[model samples]
Structures are given as C-alpha cells and as structure tokens.
Target: MNFIKSLDDKVWMTAKARYNASARLNKKHQALTFTISFLSVAQIVLTFCMLVDICFGFPEKVLMFIAMTTSVMILVIANQSALGSLLIESEKLHRFGIKFQSLYEEISLYIKLDKANKSVEEGFQQRYSQLLREADINHLKIDEELVKAERKSFELNPICALWIKFKNLVAIYLSSFLYLAIPLGLLWGASWLK
Candidate 1:
C-alpha cells in the first residue's frame, strides 16, 4: 500500500513539473512571434531606407547591412529549426501549452476528489504522455533561464543568473542596435545639412 501510494504521488508530482516547464516554454515560444515581427519589420524598414538612399555615411550603410544580414540569417534559422512553420508552429506551442494547463487542472480536481482510482490514474498518465508527444517541441536554455528568473526559485547560481541575464539583454536589444544606429548616423549627418 505504501509503495502504491508513493507511485501515485510521483505521477501527480511529475505532471505538475511538466506543466510548469511547458507553460514557461509556451511563453518563450510566444516571444518568438514578437521576435519574428520585430526583426522582419526592422529589416524591411532598413532595406527600404537603403533603397531610399538613407545612407548618411559609410557607417549608416554598415549598420543597415548588419541589420539586414541578421534578419536573413534568422529567417533561415527559423525555417531550419524546430521553430519551423515559423509563426504557425509557435502558435501551436502555445496551444499545446493550453492543453497542458487543462490537464493540470484536471489532475488537481481528481486529486481533490479521490486519488486512489488506479484506472483513472493510468488514464491521467497516458493523457500526460500524449500531450507531450503531440507538443513535440523543446525549449531552449534561454527559455529555462527566463523561467528560472520568473519563478525566482532560488536554484540558479549567481554567476549563471548573470550569464543568462547578459544573454537575454543582448537578445532583446540586438535588433535595436541593428536599426537604431542608422538614425543616429543620419542625425549626425544632418549637421552637414546645416
């Protein structure tokens, strides 16, 4: 009886952990949509600016070149990665996460009601596995770092936290650097207009 009780508890605990992980991954995948939109728009604008002769100096051209190159590279990577189907798959990741959320809720209700039903317990386990297989997408290390930061779980070492924070900052601001400098250069060049 004790062994069986422990097994049941383990299943429930595992489900909760999986839910937590998937929820975080879903959020990260959603960020992919923003990332796509941001880089795509920035690239289009920069490319258009280049076409419109926004070149203020060699520096502006260099900035534009760097921005567009990063955009193209990301597009290629998106297509080649599990991030395939780009926005659509990213959306799917969110949808699957919703399913996981539902499953977690169901597990909670069952636990509150009666956890001794082995058949029901097996069904829950199977459903949990199925959800995972259907989702079929994995989160990245950055996603893990983001989740850890969000949860403030106190498991992350200080050095590791700082490392991930630096990486996150770079990722969040990289696109800005790509497109922002052109304006600065143009502003400085505008002085020549004076």
Candidate 2:
C-alpha cells in the first residue's frame, strides 16, 4: 500500500513540475510579445516626431534624428529577440512531446507486466488497470491536442517569417531616412543661419 501511495505521489509531483515549467514558458512568451509591441509603438511615435521636427524647422533637429535612429535600432533588436524566443519555445514543445511519448511507452510496459503477473493481488491488479486506462486516455487526448497546436504553429510560421522580413526592411528604410535627413537638415540649417 505504501509503495502504491509513493508511486501515486511521484506521478502527481512530476505532473506539477511540468505544469510549473509550462506556466513559466507562457509568461516569458507574453513578456516578449508585450516588449515587441511596445518597441514598435515607440518607433512609430519617434518617426512621427522626427517628421514634425523637419517640417517645423525645430531647433532640436539633431536630437530628433538621434531619437529616431535609436528607436529604429531598438525595434529591430526587439523583433529579432521575439523571433528567437519563439523558435526556442517551439523546440522545447517538440522535445516535451517526445518525452511524453516515452513516458506513455514506459507506463504501457508496466501495465503489461501487471497483466502477466497473475499471482498479483486482485485489488492491486484492478487498481493498476484502472490507473493505466485513465493514463492512456489522458495521454491520447494530450497527444491529439498537441498535434493540433503544432499544426497551427506551422501555419503561423510563414506569416511570422514574412513579418520579420518586413520589419528588417522597415528598419533599413528608417535608418536610411534618418541618415539622409541629418545631412539635409545640416544644409538647411546652414542656409537659414546665413
């Protein structure tokens, strides 16, 4: 009875550990998403400010240029970080799925062993069978759900790839705009000063 109790406790503990790890991963994902969104917003705001400064002959044109350049760099970095995190998360999930498959195989082997031991206590056999059946059903359901999730992830992969490419292009364009504006602003300022 103690042995069965210990096994049950161990199983529950393992499940709890996995749950915690998954929760932590989810939190990290959310954080990355928030960070990327914030950076994009900041970039847009800074770009607009730079344009306004250029139009109004704002005295702090150099500062505006610096702000715009900095924002663009930050946005690019944030986008790349988000993409890297997503790739890491996908790999982790794939590895976890494989681990679950191994766990299922091990449990199935235990069930088979119990079945072959006819001399085992009747109550123990019955309980073992019930637990095995429940675990099997749960495992199948989780596998099916994971498959669906993986399919969705694959579907989104191309979209994300395109988005990353778009971000890089935008970053390059913004950088060039800032670079060109500096010399133009300097010439304009010089003429105005004269």
Candidate 3:
C-alpha cells in the first residue's frame, strides 16, 4: 500500500517535515543572533578604541577624520544588523519550533489511532496553517532545502552534495563573518599604523 494514500499519513508527513524544517531554522536564527550580536559588540569595542585614538591625537589629521567616520558607520551598521535579527525574533522562532513539534506529534497520534478521516485531516491542516500565520515569518529557503536533504539523503551525486554543502556554508556562516571581518580588518590595520 502507498503509505500516503491515507489523509492522516499525509498530514503526519507534512507536519513532521515542517517541524524538522522549523527546528533547523531555529538553529540558524539562534546562530545568527549570537554571531551577529558578538560581532556587533566587537565592532562597538573597536569603535571605542578608535574614539580613544582620536582623543589622544594618535592619528594623523586625515586618518583621524577617516577613523571617526568609520566609527560612526560601524555604529550605524551594527544598529541596523541588530534591528534586522533581534534576539526576540530568534526567541519567537524557537517557540514556533516547539509549536510545530507539538503539531507534528498531534498528527502522529491521530494517525496511530486510525482516525484518518477527512474532517480530522482538514482540522489538522487548518491548525498548521493557523500556526504558520501566527508565526508572522517563515523559515528561510535553505531550511526547507536542508529538511528535504535529510529525507533524501545520499540521493545526490558527490559533486551535487559538495556544491550544496558549500553553498550552505557560505550562506549560513561565511557571509556573516565576512561582513564584520572586512570592516574589522580595515580598522585593525589602521590601528597598526598608529
């Protein structure tokens, strides 16, 4: 028998996939929240040092002006990044992940009980949709892709898998790091000249 022929099976499958995706998304958000936050703090500290240098007449006039401007830009960008991915949003995503987990379990139970009727399926589907609406924001596409990957593990050729992993690495980790690293490197190099 095609397992998914039953409505409850379909609902349970979708809910389980969604829950897994949400969990991955939550992890991504938490990582972004922590990484961006740490980088912002480091930027602020670097900016403070630049200000100190300005006060002490440690840099040439032109360099001092550049440093001051750079400091302001750093502060502005840090504020923007913080606003873009607030800790509260990450916490909200975490809560949503739990909610998805609950929904998944509920559907599984319904399936186990052989209560796979149209009404039950529709109700659970509506609940899923409502939960998504309440979330107010959806998981990133990468999260969905990762969940699909888990379900279809080793199906892709080695080259394809490597490409996907590389893309994920760059998107999830390297991009954020480079955003801060480039500016920090410039500031650090500027410091060395002082």
Q: How high is each candidate's TM-score?
A: 0.49, 0.38, 0.60
* Highest-TM-score candidate: 3
Q: Rank the candidates by TM-score, best first.
A: 3, 1, 2
The alpha-carbon root-mean-square deviation between model 3 and the true structure, to one decimal in Å, is 5.3
Worst lDDT 10-window in candidate 2: 136-145
Candidate 2, residue 141: Cα displacement in angstroms equals: 28
lDDT of 1 by residue, 98-153 (tens): 67667767766776675577777777778877776776764445655655654454
Residue 163 displacement (Å), model 1 = 4.5
Displacement of residue 3 (Cα, Å) in model 3 is: 9.5
lDDT of 2 by residue, 35-116 (tens): 4455556556656766666434444555455456555545654665464664465445444544444454454455556544
Better TM-score candidate (1, 2) = 1
In candidate 3, what are the lDDT values of residues 146-170, reduced to their tens digit? 5545556438666666666565566
| lDDT value, residue 37 of candidate 3 | 70
